[model samples]
Target chain A: MEDRVKRIEKALDHFLPERKGSLSETVTDAMRYSLLNGGKRVRAVLTLAFCELCGGDEDMAMPFACAVEMVHAYSLIHDDLPCMDNDDMRRGKPSNHKFYGENYALLAGDGLLTKAFETALSSEAFRNVGMERAAYAAAVLARCAGEHGMVGGQCIDLATENRTVSLDELCEKDTGKTANLIMAACMMGCIAAGANETQINAAKEYALHIGLAFQIRDDILDVTGDAKELGKNIGVDAQNARCTYVSILGVEKAQALVDEHTEKALHALDAFDADSTFLHEFAEKLATRSK
Target chain B: MEDRVKRIEKALDHFLPERKGSLSETVTDAMRYSLLNGGKRVRAVLTLAFCELCGGDEDMAMPFACAVEMVHAYSLIHDDLPCMDNDDMRRGKPSNHKFYGENYALLAGDGLLTKAFETALSSEAFRNVGMERAAYAAAVLARCAGEHGMVGGQCIDLATENRTVSLDELCEKDTGKTANLIMAACMMGCIAAGANETQINAAKEYALHIGLAFQIRDDILDVTGDAKELGKNIGVDAQNARCTYVSILGVEKAQALVDEHTEKALHALDAFDADSTFLHEFAEKLATRSK
Candidate 1:
């Protein structure tokens, strides 16, 4: 792994606690379980990469990295709520509601979402960015996390239940529910490090392509990958008859689309002069990952 | 009625439909009823009062005013959930979950909480405050609404179930969950309008007293008031054996405490040269109001 990626991983590990000793033990545990489960920390890695690529300090981007991960984890918790997906397992273990009960799971998700910004605002990294930049970053995070962003996307996804949706519509749903927050993560790093508008826009573009590509790959994985490899139950989407890129485009065409998105993502990165070998390679590998 | 209070109510009615679409009809309608079913609009009114008092334009403070009300509504929704108070009625009508199913009620609460920020950020009022101020206000609102504020207080309250909590501990929980958000509303308005630290601090102090007094009066009302006047059911605290200020201090002592807090709230207004008559009288009247 690259040093920046390693740094993000290390920071995330350091940031999560086994217990906070509050009354919200089950909620905190649910947060810790998903957060610490050994995913690739893709969002944080991308944030660190983009911040470094923009000739900015990675130290200033660490909180943004953690914030993105917390938001991601919280989304996963809510997505698994009985009202939403009714899923029983996540990351190969009992889902939050399964273990914590529905009410605690709900509160836990809400707490994590709120805590992400609190963590971001209180970070030394934020102080380094100054109040204006910190505020800007918070606003960006809020927009992506709130209704017009991730939650809005979730609303659309829920609305599509038992209905056929076109490929464009699927992309629209994925863009908001999954892609927008990821894009916000990358953009937030740039904003936190005080990158120029040019750098920020380029990073945003890169994030948009990669985020969509990531979801497409996820759709592809759901259809073809084994549960052991994906760390999740495969074919669940097919069971739900949920419209996805894979469902609409077929596996072969979905693979092609991932490649096209990877190319587009790299194209956006071309604007940055700083080395982005890690980012470029990350995009390419996202297409090939089994999970 | 105050012009700003009327304006906030008008805006609440206007923005109510901006969020709901047809699909989530049950959940959306429940949210609408709780939000539109009139209360005093006290928190939003406080926000507007602080902004005008601090020499900030009310127009710039209005979106945030709406946001506070939304947050307040969300707290009520969650507080009345089955695992919590399980209140069937609020403001003399069926609570959100009582009309909607429990599951839909949960989602509706989530939807309203998410919409609060979206409404705030998307508003021209927020933009008028400048990005820096808006971001600060957003952060404040998030902290107040999230675990460290209202949600955290609820968690503690739940933990203290079926037991006696000391006056200090009860105060701490009530203050954090209830007063904290109200304080945030006042501070956020001042910050939104670019109030200096001195003005912000004064408003915060005033908010602290009123908020605690409000909760204390609530406990008192629970014991003394009837079902018709207070709306919802009466004597819920006694029925649930909940630990509240009145439960801990007894009715006479709680009433004395409310008076003390109300006087202190008014005294805090003395720090500012601006006409705080509405805010001062508002606090005093809030203490004695029936229903």
Candidate 2:
């Protein structure tokens, strides 16, 4: 996991614009400051792990992995905007909008999102994946992250704020908001490896299960985790009146859901011939994570 | 021109998500509101005209044309945010943020940008252009819109705000901010048609000239055109303390620059073997138009 994080970090540094460029220093600096702040690199790691498990070249997966992280980072930056989450702190430090004024922070987020595709499209590693597959994968990323997916989920979150939401509504939001990108990561790996449809479908199902499990654990942590370990103010969901797994089902039931989903995630991989020890361990860790 | 506008409108309607879909109604409504609002659709028109001139099927060009407009609309939406340009209206109507609030406005911009690529990638029309060409075209769009192009120009615009800058610096900023996308539209047309490198280069040069001219004319209009004529507030460049062609080089010199660039634009098209009469007329109209 540490090596995976390092690899993702190195690729990100190489892929992002150099700090010395003549472009807007403030925007680029803000972009770098947030992107390189060293999160868990979960999405990138998932991409690489899935690629390796499917017998694809890890080198070919690096660009897509980095691109996923960029998308994730961009989402976070926007999510923390005053007009959005209004978060002053993220990952234990000042949020993007807090650090760079709102204007620069907004443009910085746009820059990161645009750069993700530019990097993905221009990458030699991506070219090695073949244009057809690359286009397909790029399309997947766009669909999963755009209004139809994460953006839509965000809209629903705002629309339902301070309102009681049914479990079904919460599930719909969670699926769109969290599982889409994870599914994209797994699908991208399968595409890069030239995996068959069955393998791709299985991987997607695996991602959905683990993604739900991950989110459930996050909800649990929001109420119980310490601020320092959580790397931001905890109990934000409750304060926002967001309906979460823990809020809807309570902690014990939410934990049970996480366990069931994690088991299903591992079960989804039964069709694959390759060793998936890392993925299994990763899912377990995410399900039981403190932060 | 009216027919071209209608064609662009129809394509956009077909390509954008329906407002009644299950996705967050607010986000999609915001997207449709801003996108379908009666803007000039210049980028899409340029793409279609150039593609037809290059002997590509116009139907096949529609997807890329709509994508270009989506990008343009997204930029306008983001640029009008309170944190950015802070405009209250666009196209004689309430700006996205004014109507939807800043948060939804921000997400709507993101949704449009992401949808641009998704529409491009999923187009059966695009598939007929071939994967390598489609990928190449997509990369061109991203670069023109992303850090290396429009976003970079935006950065410079902000960085140089309230400061005097050289004409060269101003040109560089304009080149990145505006010309890049115009140039991209032309390049994508050529790419779709499988035009040779020289033809593609000529299209780019032509685009750059016209793009700069178009922007210079915009600066002139901002000061002289009525709010009703332009469908938004005028004289904003001076109010914002921003550097523009009209501000840096008075109206006379800015008008002179527009003429020079327009001529240069027509001259660059001499290398192409196509009926360029319409393009010639279009350039003259763009340079001389009141709004």
Worst 10 residues of 2 chain A by lDDT: A119-128
**Which candidate leads the pack in lDDT?**
2
Cα lDDT tens digits for candidate 2, A1-291:
687788788889988857675746677888888899989888888888888888998887887888788888999999999899999999999999898888888888888888877766775645678777777777888888888788888888888886898888887788878888888888788877778889889889999999888888889999989999889999899887788988889999999999999999999888689999988898889888997
True contacts kept of each: 0.37, 0.70
Tell me the TM-score of candidate 1's A chain: 0.94
Which lDDT tens digits does candidate 1 get at residues B187-261?
988987798898888888888899999999988888887779888687888887788887678889998999999
- Kindly report which residue stretches of model 1 are placed more than 4 angstroms away from their true locations once superposed: A2-6, A9-30, A123-126, A196-199, B12-37, B92-94, B97-108, B118-127
lDDT value, residue A87 of candidate 1:
91
Error of 2 at A54 (Å): 1.8
Q: Which candidate is the best by TM-score?
A: 2
Considering only N, C-alpha and C atoms within 3 Å, which residue pairs clash in candidate 2? none
lDDT score for residue B72 of model 2: 86
Which CAPRI level is candidate 1?
acceptable
